[model samples]
Target: MRERWRQGRAARRAHHRRRGLRARLTRMFALVAILAVVLTTVLTVGATFRVLAQFGPGVGADTAWDAATWQQVASGAGRSIIRSAVQAAFLSALLAIFVAGLVTRQLTRPLARLADGAERLRAGDRSVQLPIPPRQDELRDLTATFNDLTLSLARQEAWRRGLVADIAHDLRTPLAVLRSEIEAMQDGVQPLDGAALARLHGEVLLLARLVTDLRTLSLAESGALSLEPRLLDAEEALRGLAEAYSVRAVEAGVTLTVHASSPLPLHVDSDRLRQALGNILDNALRYAAPGPVKLSAWADGEGTHLSIRDDGPGFRPDDLARAFERFYRADASRTRDPQGRASSGLGLAIARALVEAQGGRLAARNHPEGGAEFTLTFPVPSGEPPSPQTRMVTRAPSSSR
Candidate 1:
């Protein structure tokens, strides 16, 4: 009971100490108005007495009045002026207070709403949004900024929740498989043979890959990914990538080709760029089996452009919109590669993260020739020019499937 009493007393003190901005502003305006009225009245009364001394009771007249009469006349006129000035000042002061109240109310209403909305936000309500004032003033700008902040917080919260769910769902499948396999072997329902061991090993590898991809993605998105950037010939890099993946293309019965109009210079991290390119190529090959895949590079006034086009089915509208989302696959049923290896569904996401980390952009769309195309653009640094070699290079495998 004593503790409760202490709490109640503290609450009372806090309430008393809470001086509102509206009240303070109103008081300030009232004080200023009253001061102005008093100052004006004093000046007006002084001016009236001076004028009376100059022209009243016989000054500049044929018959001049005595000093005593002049003094009496001046006193009477001064008193009358003071009385009228006081009355006018009193009425003006009242009007000033009323206007001050109205103005202060108008100003403080938005501030009060903002404070309430901020309190709600502090209590973990991300959706708290204040109504924006219609007046084109600082208050409106402030409210708009607050609304933007609220929207950003909401989006981040949603993304965090979705990430957790996706991680759990991805982990559950491989874990379940591993547990079931081990349990079956222990129960003597399945033989401890090479195939069984291989299956278990595959699940373990899938789990490891998923974890690694997640870490890389997290680091990239958080701007912590280390990059060793250098200037390199774009044509040479494309040729090297094509050569590296030629064997895979041949096995998949796909024709891989690289084309460059000239030696385009690019400044980027070589290893990271290769990884991003490899991931996109792998994705294209996965879907465009037995079809032609083209790699083209060029530099223009805008930037350096690298495009990969695959003669396969393009993305649906929904898939295109969410292509960079983690663990988002257009065809949910196909979760494994043709070789029966599990896919973590983070390839496109990782590619985008890596590209963006290097200050570049990646985009996907349907090519005019009815195929999926992915383009990567890297901005040229200021005061830098394209490579002067100007040699056009086109590399293709000697044998095409």
Candidate 2:
């Protein structure tokens, strides 16, 4: 155990040390080479001056430093100054090679990390994080940019896994429901009354919801999350969500409330805004234990705002941090809901993506008063179309949700 601990400490210390030494060595070695060149220049100038002085200030073939004695001066300078310069140049070049090698080693650290990260990704590791240096040097920026890419890749990998699991789990519930209903009919245990038919219909509706959400996810991932911004009534948007989910809320025994401080006006993608609002509302209704589902919107100093809060079982610290991760179910069990109903869990992820794609921000938190609140903040139109439209989205057929 002690040997293992020592090895760990050594590795950590070496890693931290290597993190900066490349840049440091590069600057130091370049400075030393320049200084050496400067020194050689000064010495060569001095040798020229010494020869001029010996020639008695008159540069002529017959002077003391002239033809016959010029050989001595020339030989002396070449034997000493030129040779010394040659040696010095060779030494500095050698030093430069050493420094360059060390610096290159440091620089390649990121490349090595990139390779390792790629290999781990290839090996299906979604938890890899690349080490990047602090400043914004070109190589450091490249490393940071690569790490950012890796981070995004890791997130998408996680999303892909969640999507598969959600699909399997989602299919199980409906298939089981349909299977049970079919078996009952075959066994004549329960007559295929409208009530029994209604259960299958509900299952089909749930399946439809799952399919719709999955298709949306696929479209979003394929870079087709397009939007058309327009000036719309914020209250109307909130009302749309309320109206869509009103029946579901009623069936779930959850009250839906729409509170807006009089038509909060804003510029936004109407359909995307509606979808975001619906997702939040749906999530609140689905997860909240018998309680009120509150939808509220208003204008703050920054922009228009909308939130859906529920007096449900709120998230814990871990869950809240990753609540927007696609299909990340805090309640992973199948038997936790009030009516044993479960979710596909992509609601919040899609909601936040849509919100952000509109030059807005969305966040989820546990209300101090005992529920979870998701807030979407949008920037008010600044009297001009944003440059090239919102950047986080790609173009697709426009729709009003």
Candidate 3:
């Protein structure tokens, strides 16, 4: 019984294992052979009479085809005609074989690639780069579509990993605080009061801020961040940001200086412009020595630039390279705020997003003499973005904001 079942299964499998060409080619060759005989007979008869006419015209188109004469004509004509037809048919078959091989190979290349890709996909290999032919025809379009699917899948995988990490990190601190609060209350070690309530409030706020920043950054990167652009008073924007950061700087024992060329207006969103300055100011104040925080703005022909420099231990020479990556903190400056307080490391990343959404540019670098400088540049009020200068260097790929 088992042997019979196994045989049945094997037969079923064999049913789908297609014999692609042998059966079809055999039938086609049989049909060609029969057609060739009829064609040869017809042509031979016509040729014999015509050839016999050159021997004599007295048959008057009614020459009696006697057995001997007919047999002789048939034998001679059939041999010659059949031989030539055989040669011609062989040559045609050889040519057809070569042409069929070429066309079949060309047409099946894409199908072959599709098969290979399926095998790799079964093996879970996502980085395979199977390129499609670059013709403007249907094959090219199909290849392009496959490439897009591969890229989209890769991106989604990466996004999944990143989101998981971000979420875990985001949850860790807040959860730890909440746990500690509950433990303290349970043990009667600390009473729930104004101080405890405030701490809890702060932690919740921090958690909320992280969620908000993540959403904002995602929106900006996905091209969904909306902008409200207008003519910006660059001087006013700088002054407001400087004032906001001055108190924080003074508390940290750093002098704050805000300088602006009077009323330099720009084609920008006022709120986003202020956010850009605020981010620079916060970074400067956070890293500056207990000495000075300098914020300055000026217009240069077709564009305007704002600079914030701090005397504190500014960014290291290489730290400028990845300053705007979300959650990244410089190795030397990941501690507390100026007053020895904690901070979410998303400030610069959020600031960069806002700047980019408005089609502007921002970057950070080490000051020549000493310290760190963040420069945010925008096209001046001439209604178009300014062309970059010959010697000016770019550190980060800036946004259009």
Candidate 4:
């Protein structure tokens, strides 16, 4: 009963506030109209009195009455004029009140709709979209903005739902594996040997990796990730990464190479940069087997550019558009490797996040030469010049592999 009373009182207060807009507008319009009528009436009465004073017997006239007669005539005329003016003013005020009502109604209709839409939105209705007004005015602009706000809210809500579902799906697989392995050992169906324990450990590691990647992605996206940025040689970094991953490339029957036409300087977090590039390179080696993967770096007027290109089946149109969405795999075959190791599908998303957190942009496109290309661009810091050294480094696949 107390809750009901509270709600009722709140509703009453809201209604009271809502009524104020129309009341204030009506009062304002009526006040202006009444002031205009009164001013006109006053001017008309004053003009009549002035004319009477000028033309009556008191003034220089040829055939006028005596002063007392003139005074009486003026007084009677003044009374008649005053009566007509008062009657006209009364009628005008009534008309003004009626017009004020219509005007206020027209003005508050759109506002009322907007208020209702806002209330629905507050009530968890993400799809509430208000109709825009037809007239080109401030009200119409406000309505358009509100519609845009609703659209953005709907998109965010959808993304949130998708994120939760993806996380659950990714977690369920490794968890199932762990449960099954433990159950088998407990039932004496499988020996609790080194191989079995190793298998279980691998699944645990997968789970840990997924959780870590999710945390990193969240931090990067929320601008809460810590970074230690400094000036670094972009060309050298590319060469170093290429050398580090060359063995893996060769193991997969792929050739990994780095090419730099000139020295390129960049201001960035070295560790983060390596992390982003490593993710892309790993993807390239995984999918572009038996083909060539190339890393290139250069600097131009725009900024420093680092790109990884692979001579494999390029990305499909849909993949190119959503390659960075978390846990979005273009093909079901991409869900696991040939060795049966599951993919968390957050590699590209985390890479993009890390790059963007450092004020750089990452983009994916199908190379014109028939392969996939991922590029990273970073802005050059002020007062820093590119190295003048004109050198190039290239590493090729080992013939023994």
- lDDT per residue for candidate 1 within 334-376, as digits (tens), equals 7875657678889899999999999999999988879899999
- Local accuracy of candidate 3 as per-residue lDDT tens digits, 296-359: 7777763688887877676655667878866767854554565655556777887777777777
Query: lDDT per residue, candidate 2, 1-401, as tens digits?
Result: 66999999787557645654555665677787797788778766776666557645566566444477777767875666676577667777777787778777867887788888789878977677777766445567567777787678877777677767767977888899899899999999989899999888878877887788877766665658777888887777777676666666666777777777655667888887888887777677667846776777777566777788889879999999989886677777632345655466778888877777777899889999989999998876666332221111111112222
Q: What are the TM-scores, per candidate, against the unseen true structure?
A: 0.81, 0.65, 0.64, 0.81
Name every residue pair that clashes in candidate 3. 288-312, 289-312, 358-401, 359-400, 359-401, 360-400, 360-401
Decoy 1 TM-score against native: 0.81
The 10-residue segment of model 2 with minimum total lDDT is 388-397
Model 3: lDDT to the true structure: 0.68
- Model 2 lDDT on a 0 to 1 scale: 0.73
Instruction: For residues 1-401, write the lDDT of model 4, one tens digit per residue.
Output: 66999999788557645554445566777687777677667756775776577556555545667789778877877776777677667777677777777766877899999999999999999898888777544566678899999999999999999999999988998899899999999999999999999999988988998999999999999999999998888888998887787777667777777777455778899999999998898778767777888888877777788999999999988889998999998786667654466577899999999999999999999999989999999997787766555555555667332
- List candidate 3 stretches off by more than 4 Å: 1-100, 103-107, 118-124, 130-160, 299-302, 331-335, 340-342, 381-401
The number of the candidate with the highest lDDT is 1
Using lDDT as the measure, name the better of candidate 1 and candidate 4: 1
Better of 1 and 2 by lDDT: 1
Clashing pairs in 4: none
